[model samples]
Target: MSSTDHAAAVHQVHRDDYGSRLGMWLFLFTELILFGGLFIVYAVYRFMHQQEFHLAAQELNTTIGLINTIALLTSSMTAAMSITAMQKGNLRFSKWLIWVTIGFAFVFMVNKYFEWSAKIHHGIFPGSKDLLAKPDGEILYFGLYYVMTGLHTFHVIVGVIFFLFILRQIKQGKITSDRYVRLENSALYWHLVDLIWIFLFPLFYLIH
Candidate 1:
């Protein structure tokens, strides 16, 4: 109850917040590396089979891709709004925003499933699909498509889990308007997901 004891407690709280922030940044860095490798692969393919890739790109479901893009961008907006609510110490509002974002994310995933299945059913899938009846190595284009989008899907799944954890933290009173670093970090992750899709849309569905 003494002034010195109160000061010590405040300092400990600041230190704990700093540690959480640092951990989040470190994790973000690791995520950067994981996405980096995929970018490299995309570059190599773009350079190696520019024509085939372009042709393949034209075959992609651009409408579906654009729809998914909008969904993700909307989710990102909701996430940003959630963070703002958290900063305002409005936990209830923040939770609702988070739930809204999760809903959009799920919709994105479901749309992607349809897009993929359509391609797969048409025999335009990866690994020399017999469905499309394409020539050898021609189907390689679809191979890259699957790998890139598949990896991106995995990232979304991870983001969903992370978001759920953040919500739990908020519920437990571990997070507050005064100390919600986890929300910001989760936003960063969501933005990364959006960024990847931004590039992906053009590469897989808009090239000519």
Candidate 2:
């Protein structure tokens, strides 16, 4: 093949990679707007019912929140480092780091499950007799708490699935040093998950 033709082909490949990254960023933008709407609702309700919100938030377990925060932050580090490892041509090490990040995600989920179970056992879920008797502000607070956290939990599950896909691609030799955008995009999504939780942990757990 002619040198000019080869150059054009290489340029097209990079262009496609850039296009994929752009698409991912656009999707992430939509996700941000989605959560932003929820944050606005939270703020308005908190403004209207400061005392009740405060009281209800006190019921959340701060210790679990803190632990999950650390776990996610650490996982974010691992996810980022995985890309670095892949760039360094340490493919095996990259895969291991991705698995570690997935492990942390599971830990976060387990902690979340226990926390929710405790609340449910105490009859604190929405529409339960105990929660129903609470003031409207507290009820709304718990309601949003369930919704936002539940949505975030779903994102975590999706992220785990995405990481699994990345693992499969890596094993199949589809993601590598020269073509690693998929891995980078996966890490970006995971970081977004961690970032959302950073905000969530403080708003629901520490604010009280």
Candidate 3:
């Protein structure tokens, strides 16, 4: 290729990368808006039923929530590390860090499973007889609990899938030191996931 043509191609690539990052940021902004609305709703209800919210929060296992928080926080770090590894041209290490992030995600999910199972076993789920018998504030608290945390759980699953795809791309030599915007975007998404849970852990488990 001629020098001028090569320069034009390089400029096009840079524009594409910039566009991709911008798109990802816009998408993340939407996610934030969604969660932000829920948070507002939560705040209003909690303000109206402070004691009940406090009591309902006590029903949650703080230890398990703490463990999950740690897992997600660690996973976020690993995700960032994976991007750095890629930028440093350490493909193998990058892949390994991604795996570690996935492993932490698994840990978080497993703890969530047990925690949810316990709640269900206690008949505390929405529409259950036990939940229906609770005070309105407690009921509302649990309702928000399940909705917000459930939504966050879905994001965690999505983040895991994104990482899985990223791992495959890395192995296929599609994602590399020169081209890793996809990985970077996925890491950003993961960080958002972790951040949402940071809010959730305190709201649902530590309020008491």
Candidate 4:
């Protein structure tokens, strides 16, 4: 059938349809711009206060950041593979793979929890210089660090919620080879969260 027919078919049950995808893409573009601005600000600070930034970066746990990086990258691979599996009309495999992806997401958050807990215990909070034990100049580094990583974590939370909803849709037969837009878009969101972390790890953890 024609594209119009396919969309008309989806309109009945799929609230999003093509229009939803289009809207999501547009919204993602706005998010991209917002992150782009934050990145620019980070770059400026890093360049001007290179020494302090590097020292502040060293304050972070490279091991934890690296571990999370590996986890998220691995999850992205799993999610991509699941999409491929769905395209091949393999529901069981796709479902299992999605569950695996969610598992990795859980692991990533768990690691983040431990990492943040340690930081909090050490009293390294935003706008708390005595808490962080750093000089005034070094304050900006940690400030931006918290903001960027915190925002990225929020995105991860959103992605996890989205995938859980997709899991429900799959169980109820709302998603299948016949209609995988939900899967496809959820995968896209997951990938974006992963991509953000990739940039973040190097910027915040690898400065030294």
lDDT values, one for every candidate:
0.83, 0.94, 0.94, 0.85
TM-score of each candidate structure, all chains considered together: 0.86, 0.94, 0.94, 0.87
Clashing pairs in 2: none
* Deviation in Å, model 3, residue 124 alpha carbon: 0.1
Query: What residue pairs clash in candidate 4, if any at all?
Result: none
In model 4, where do residues sit more than 4 Å from their true spots?
1-20, 129-133
Q: Write the per-residue lDDT of candidate 3 for residues 21-107, one digit (tens) a residue.
A: 899999999999999999999999999999999988889999999999999999999999999999999999999999999999999
Candidate 1 global CA lDDT score: 0.83
> Please, what are the lDDT tens digits per residue for candidate 1 over residues 1-208?
9999999888874446677767877887886788778778778867877777777676787788889999999999999999899988889999999999899889999998998887777766655337357633346667778888899999898889989999999999988998888788888888889888888888788887
Tens-place lDDT digits, model 4, residues 1-208: 9999988888876365687678778878887887889999988887888888877777789999999999999999999998889889998899889888889888888998888888777778785656457765478887887788888888888888988898889889988887888888888888988888889998888876
Candidate 1: worst 10 consecutive residues by lDDT?
128-137
TM-score, structure 4 vs. true: 0.87
Candidate 2: stretches off by over 4 Å:
1-15
TM match of model 1 to true structure: 0.86
Q: What TM-score would you give candidate 3 relative to the actual structure?
A: 0.94
Better of 1 and 2 by lDDT: 2
Q: What does candidate 2's lDDT look like per residue over 31-93, in tens digits?
A: 999998999999999999999988998899999999999999999999999999999999999
Task: Evaluate residue 184 in candidate 4 and report its C-alpha lDDT on the 0 to 100 scale.
Answer: 82
